[model samples]
Target: MTTLELHGLRVRRGGRDVVHGIDLTVNEGEVTALLGANGAGKSSTVLGVAGLERDTAGSVTVDGTPIRGLAPNRVRRAGVATMQEGHRVFGDISVADNLRIAALLLPSPARSGAVEEVLALFPELETLADRPAGSLSGGQQQMLALATALAARPRFLVIDEMSLGLAPLVVARLVPALRQVAESGVGVLLIEQFTQVALELATRVTVLAQGLVTLEAPASELRAHPERLTAAYRLTA
Candidate 1:
């Protein structure tokens, strides 16, 4: 199985270490939730592993091959795709254009097929293919961002804040899609603020507090013992 591994992972920002040494693993066909309050270093940790931060220190590997220092594009090419926090669709471009741009990483012969497959996964996009991405509602825009990531055919997906600013109904609709992605054999690292929502989707869970991992356990264990998460949230807050 394809797996993404992080060992002694550390991230520094503005001359301060935001994430301390942490070890994490994401296995294909599983959902791993990274949970914490604001400033708990959840985002920074994933960004560093995704090669979006230059001050990152640690070892990141895919399938046991070192890729900690690679460029973001190279990391993407190695089968890891990131859906950054907030909506990332291009406001001025057509929805098709947004997808096409993301598909650029694929080989020429595969680009068109990739776009078609992703759109199929998000059928709502097909009806709005020619509409400007900026015109879509918040939920639709977020869905587009997810579709764009899927267009890359990633083996490991790192999504930062999947439910930010989304209404309950919108989130309800999107969560199943994400579960489907995991069921389809993609290793997913989900950064979510809503504890209940993340727990619902994750097979395993890790909690970061004050830049340190306070909890790492199977979701079933946490689900059975809900009180165990109190320390993680208290420290993060």
Candidate 2:
């Protein structure tokens, strides 16, 4: 059931370690939410898996194949895709074109079909496909980023800061998309701000503090032991 595994992973920024020998596994078909306050090494954890930051030392395996030295595109082709914060899409390009650029490895006939697949998942994007990406709202952009990742048909998704700034309705809408993705048997690693949202979707959750994993428990257990999470995050005031 394991899809992605990080063993003894260490990442450094500015010559100082930010992720301290962290280890975690994302199982197939389950939503594993990685939760923490800002600067909790949550992003670093996800980024390390995506091969975004070089100089990271650890073993990252996808389906048991080592991905430590693989390029971003290679890592992505290996079925681990990332939807980083801000949903970095081409602001000047049409949504369809943006997807086309992302579907670099996708063949021609399959590309359109895949775009349609995401459109079906995010129906709001169907009408706006021809419009420039910059024209879409923040929520729309987030949906597009997620759709783009889905288009690649990744087995595991690493999302960072998915609900940074948005209305409650928009945030509410996003969580279901994640559920839909997980229901389809894809593993999801979400880094989120709305603790309530994480509490709701995560089958399992882990709490990170100052680059160290402090608490990892079933979401249900965490809910019952909210004080443990609070203390791990220094929220005991």
Candidate 3:
């Protein structure tokens, strides 16, 4: 099984440390939620793990293979795909084209199959295949963004703030898709501010407060003891 681990991970920006030595782990067939307040360094941690932040100091290993300090593209090639906040789909492109662009990293012969596979996962996308991505509803656009990443067929997925600015109904619709992905044996690292949503999706939860891990517990534990999240959520709230 593929596993991602971050050991003593520290991130500094503008000469100040934002993430202070946090450790996290995600295993295949599980979803790990990363929770924190605003400016708590959640973004920094995930980006650092994805190799998007070059100044990061620590170790990021995938199945015991060191990946820290490697380029973001290289990390993706090594089986990690990240979906940043804002559902980053190309506004001017058609849904099909957006998925095709994500598959560019794959061999030519496999690109078509990749697109087909992702579209199958997001059946709503099949109906909007020819529509401009910008014309889709917010939920649909988010779906397109997720589809783009799925088209890459990564072993590990890192998603930051997936429910941001989305309606409850929209977010509700997307949750099942994510659960299906996790059930398919992909290690998922999810950074989310919404405690309820994160707890519902994650098997394990790690909370960061003021750049430090304040709590790391199983989702069931946090669910049973909701007060445990009050401090972290207050900082973010």
Candidate 4:
């Protein structure tokens, strides 16, 4: 199985280290959840891995191929794609056009097929294809963002805050879709704010506190012993 590895990763923002040296791994076909409190440097870690943050030091590799420090586009070309927070999408463009644009990295012959596959994954987008992206509800926009990322056909996907401000019902709808993505063999690094949501979707869980890993355990173990996660959080506080 393929793996995305981060070794001794460090990230600095505003001239101070936000993520002190840390190690993590996301294996293909599994969801690895990264859970942390606000300001625990989760987003910084994601940005560093995706090459959006330049003040970073670490070895980010895919199956031993060093990809750290590469540009975001380069990272994507290396079979890793990131869906950043805020449900980022081209608001002025048609929903179909956004997917089409994301597929531009693939060969012309494969682009249409890629778009079709993403649409199949998020069938709701197909019905709203003609509408501008800005017109969709927040949940719909988030789905579109996820679809755009998948249109690239990446082997690894890094999602930062899959559930932030959306309603509970909307989050319920997204959980299964994400599970299908992981089941299809894409390594998923999920940074989630909702602990239960992460626990439900993850095979393994890694908790960060004060920019350090406070706990790493099987999701089943944490689920069975909820107090363990609470203790882990308390350690950082």
Q: How far is candidate 3 from the true structure (C-alpha RMSD, Å)?
A: 2.0
Residue by residue across 1-237, what tens digits does model 4's lDDT show?
A: 799999989999999999988899999999999987788889999999999998999799998999989999999999999999898999999999999999999999999999999899898999999999999999999999999999989999999999889999999989999999999999999999898999999999988888888899999999999899877775663
**Model 2, span 1-237: residue lDDT tens:** 757988888888889999888888898898888987788888887777888887689799988999976778889998899999876888999998887777766767788777777788899988998999999999899888888888867899998878888788998998998899999989999888888898888888988888888888898987788787777786321
Better of 2 and 3 by lDDT: 3
* TM-score for each model: 0.97, 0.95, 0.95, 0.98
Q: Model 3, range 112-179, lDDT digits (tens) per residue?
A: 99999988889999999999999999889999988898888888999999999999998998898999
Ranked candidates, highest TM-score first: 4, 1, 3, 2
Better candidate number, 1 or 4, judged by TM-score: 4
Error of 3 at 73 (Å): 0.7
lDDT of 1 at 111: 95
| Runs in model 3 lying further than 4 Å from the true structure | 232-237
Of candidate 2, the 10-residue stretch with the lowest lDDT total is 228-237
Quick one: best lDDT, which candidate? 4
Q: In candidate 4, which residue ranges exceed 4 Å CA deviation?
A: none
Residue 44 lDDT, candidate 4, scale 0-100: 94
Candidate 4 has its poorest 10 consecutive residues by lDDT at 228-237
- The model with the greater lDDT, 2 or 4, is 4
Q: Supply candidate 4's per-residue lDDT for 16.
A: 97
Pairs of colliding residues, candidate 2: none
Output the TM-score of candidate 3.
Answer: 0.95
> In TM-score terms, which candidate is top?
4
TM-score of 4: 0.98
